[model samples]
Target: MTTILVPYHQDERLLDDEIPVSADITVRSQVPDGDAWQRMAGVCSATAAAVSPVVAAGGIPVVLSGDCMVAGGTVAGVQRAGVNPAVVWFDAHGDVHTLQTSTSGYLGGLSLRLLNGAHPDRYADAIGLRPVPAERTVLVDARDLDPAEVEYLAVSATRRIPVSEVSADTVPSGPLVLHIDVDVIDSGEVPGLRFPVPNGPSTDAVLAACGRLFATDRVVAFDVACPWSRTDDEGQRNIRTQLLSRLAALAHPG
Candidate 1:
């Protein structure tokens, strides 16, 4: 199948290189433009608009994003394509924070929680996105959640698994929108992240898991979020290089 690359490009003054692909869809904004929520309203709106038509036309979508909030747009696009979507969020933290609860005030930190509707509908409605019931979602490799996020997750219905268990057998069935934040892997292994967690899975382990998960034919679309700086040259240990290898594990896209 033809892969339509969706690059969520942003010049946050953090990246060390230009976006590698000529994006079929691009999400760009400056850091001072607005808060994280306002920024996502725009990013995901553009993402959904650009990606919805491509997905509806039977093309496979491969999202290369600057951060995890891209999940908002991916979910919206899959639904716009007339596909029922279950989500698999792979990250170092449980993107579950409310305006009242988050101390750091990082909006992207609320991605999965936002997807699950912890906040108002306005943010989601902006992109024509619907909330996925926590029951239909799985969160894997989130080893560094905040106190509020942890409390919410404790009561939430979303299934949580370790990075080691994120394989085909452990994931939910049916059409899926897979979200992989590169930080889900061990900080030591990847070495360059805006937010890195200790004791996360190895790149090799995650790749192996992704191989099986993708082979299931459940992934309709996927987003690979890279917070790793472009300048961090780690030879074979580069997050971008490792991400590309895992993305190739799928025999085909749904």
Candidate 2:
């Protein structure tokens, strides 16, 4: 397994960060001077370039990124390695919004939808990524959804499941790309979240769900998104560090 670190929040670089990882590769994207969407594409393309060879050589790529959108790059890299994979996306909010549907115009909100073949010109097409089918994608623990997202999921083929119930039997069949946004865990357990949702699953429950996925041995890539705000508080930083450490350990269990 190769641990890859990408220390940026969307297109912007994060400052005063303390993300704990003994990184095998740290992706530094040369974001061209452009609009927000174009810059984001630069980051994802850089990530794809970094992750492709690692997977081609038969090493599992564990990507640590600041936002969920980067998972597109991971998916592209896995495909470049010649394995078409189903996606298991775990997030606090439904990342199913498109440009027109999203009121805030946040690109991060459109992550999962883009992976399911929406807005190719903006994302998938930019990164040379082939969108994964909606039926082949599973979204877990999207307890905080917008009205637009709810309406979309009502008719979409994407399967939704609670974190506690996720396992090999429940996920889509074939190779898997497991993506977890840390905010999916209870906001109380993880401080400094930029968009915290209350009453979510505990850290232990989330880890157990991931363990079930890892136990299947079909997960080719693991994408973990750290979408939290910068915090100098020792307590907050410590909690963040411990949680990430535990999650990383799951991919390298002895």
Choose the strongest candidate by TM-score: 2
TM-score of 2: 0.97
**Which pairs of residues collide in candidate 2?**
none
* Model 2 lDDT per residue over 34-136, tens place: 8877888888888989888988898888899899989999999899889999999999999999989999988899999998889999889988999999999
| lDDT of prediction 2 | 0.90
List where candidate 2 sits over 4 angstroms from the true fold. 16-18
Residue-wise C-alpha lDDT for candidate 1, range 1-254, written one tens digit per residue: 43334444332423323224434445554334675456567777767766677679876577777777777787888898898788888888888888889899777777787788767564777667888889889999788978888898899999999867777767777888888887888888765577889887887787777766777877778777876655535563445664554564453434
CA-only RMSD, every prediction: 3.3, 1.1
Where does candidate 1 stray beyond 4 Å?
1-25, 28-36, 230-239, 248-254
lDDT to native, each model: 0.71, 0.90
Q: Please give the distance, in angstroms, between residue 164's alpha carbon in candidate 1 and its true position after superposition.
A: 2.6
**How do the predictions measure up, each by TM-score?**
0.85, 0.97
